[model samples]
Target: MMAILIAMVFKLPVDSGERNGFALTVLLAYAVYLSIISENIPSTSVSVCYLSLYLAFVLFLAAMSVVLTIFVLRAHYGTGEIPKLLKILFNCTSRSKVDVEILEKTDVGEYEHEENKLTWQIVAVGMDTVFFYVYVVLISVVTSVLTVAYIIHYRSI
Candidate 1:
């Protein structure tokens, strides 16, 4: 299976960051699930009203988790505050040598496609942007689907 192949190829180990990331991802995922449930349920029904409350609860939980994550990351890095760290994150490439080193390790590859060794850089940069755009579009489509599905469900009931 592809999963087994990936595991063998990467051999990545789970760490604290991975655990926190997974938890945050799951919280956001639950927010999406609750939003869908609340959006679809009939407004007149008690259960539907409760669904709205559930959606709000999940959204709050996700927000709190994100805030906690920001605090933890800032504290761990001794970055002073959230806003400053965010600025650093945005300016990570030019401002932080550690960030540059990490990027260099990941972005620079051994495989050479063209005669020059710069092929990996081109592929890495292009693939990163491509994936970002693809995911953004995918998220937009999902939001659109949710909106349409909610409207249709509301009209049908």
Candidate 2:
């Protein structure tokens, strides 16, 4: 769980200049975690209800991270290098849907003249960063509180 959280932190552009690699590592870690849990469950007769809940939350986090990573990579590096299956799954396109003639006629020079103008790509990256932080914080807080509560409850009995 901590590894996943760390990997997520590392995925952010602020932490690591690259995100796709860290995201892939996190996904692999998640797969290993799931495999270990599955292997342990059959040998133990103990109740796994709480474990299942944790698993669900982790799985959700993993899925969200995967999606975020895909979007970030596509937005930054583009879809040209992405696999055909993944490109299809993500519905990625190499170029914008807007007509080339329209772009050619537009006053792109005027926009470039502005000193601090925000572009769509910058906005998208900003939004992605905000969402990533919020998701990580929310999951971490909830997991920590639940873990503490569970420990206290078990100790009382």
Candidate 3:
């Protein structure tokens, strides 16, 4: 997904100001990978530091992605036509009344805010739910074995 988004930025030939948007998107991709490694901080003191840094990085990446998305949208379709675009998006849904309400409620700021919020919510909840159901349920009985090994090795001096 990050690759696809970055490709799109290049495809659009983003302006000088917007070009950093693409770079930042790529950087965020790396940040996520780095975060995964940092998640294993075993030392109690550095653990909090690593966790705090990871959270900050995640938030920064999220904000960067939102800004990049807005820049992409503006470059792709100009803000003037967003109402019509939103109307089309709304109409495509099954509920007409709900669609009108959506269209009515979405200006650039609101649209971006809601869109980013929903995207993150969906990703966080979806991954967590899937992990719990698909992985945790299947492996729950054996988790104690793995947990004990990890604690014995990583949590011990």
Candidate 4:
């Protein structure tokens, strides 16, 4: 259901920069996944604090799995190069316009509508880029917090 919703909500992105952004997010998710699983976690029974830390890490991974899955799906849709999102931001704005004569029609309004769509797509890509950075920062912060928590809990044990 979520996948279908995602597909329906996000129009098929054409910009190489946009697809690059999606692929980069997918790569970042995989990197975080590696970081989480690479830790030398102990299985020895300890205090409740340690147990809770372990639980938190597990839960984080669970949540990350969902995010990673979504990113991977989107990356597959965006078959372009590597990381690059700011390209759209430095290039587009509210006043931006597009003129593709190939997409024009006998009716001038039709061409205007297509031009408007192209302009909006630039904005959309910019928005997605912002979301990409936010997610990366968020995951990094959570990972740091949980790692620190684990170390403190282990030392106390």
Residue 57 Cα positional deviation in candidate 4, in Å, after optimal superposition: 9.5
Question: Which pairs of residues collide in model 4?
Answer: none
Number of the top TM-score candidate: 2
Worst 10 residues of 4 by lDDT: 1-10
Model 4, 1-157: lDDT tens per residue?
A: 1112222223334443354354444445545644565464544636344434544544454354445534534544554443445344435542232233324423776665664343333444444444445455555665567778889877999
Tens digit of lDDT per residue, candidate 3, span 102-134?
457668666655642323222222322332243
Tens digits of lDDT, candidate 1, 60-88: 54455455444434444442233544444
* C-alpha TM-scores of all predictions: 0.35, 0.58, 0.27, 0.34
lDDT of each: 0.43, 0.57, 0.44, 0.45
lDDT of 2 by residue, 41-73 (tens): 765666555665676667667667767766655
Please identify model 1 stretches exceeding 4 Å from their true place.
1-15, 44-48, 79-157
RMSD of candidates 1 onward, in order:
15.6, 9.3, 13.8, 12.2
Between 2 and 4, whose TM-score is larger? 2
Compute the lDDT of residue 59 as modeled in candidate 1.
54
What lDDT is reached at residue 46 by model 1?
46
For model 3, the superposed segments whose C-alpha errors exceed 4 Å read: 1-12, 15-28, 50-55, 79-157
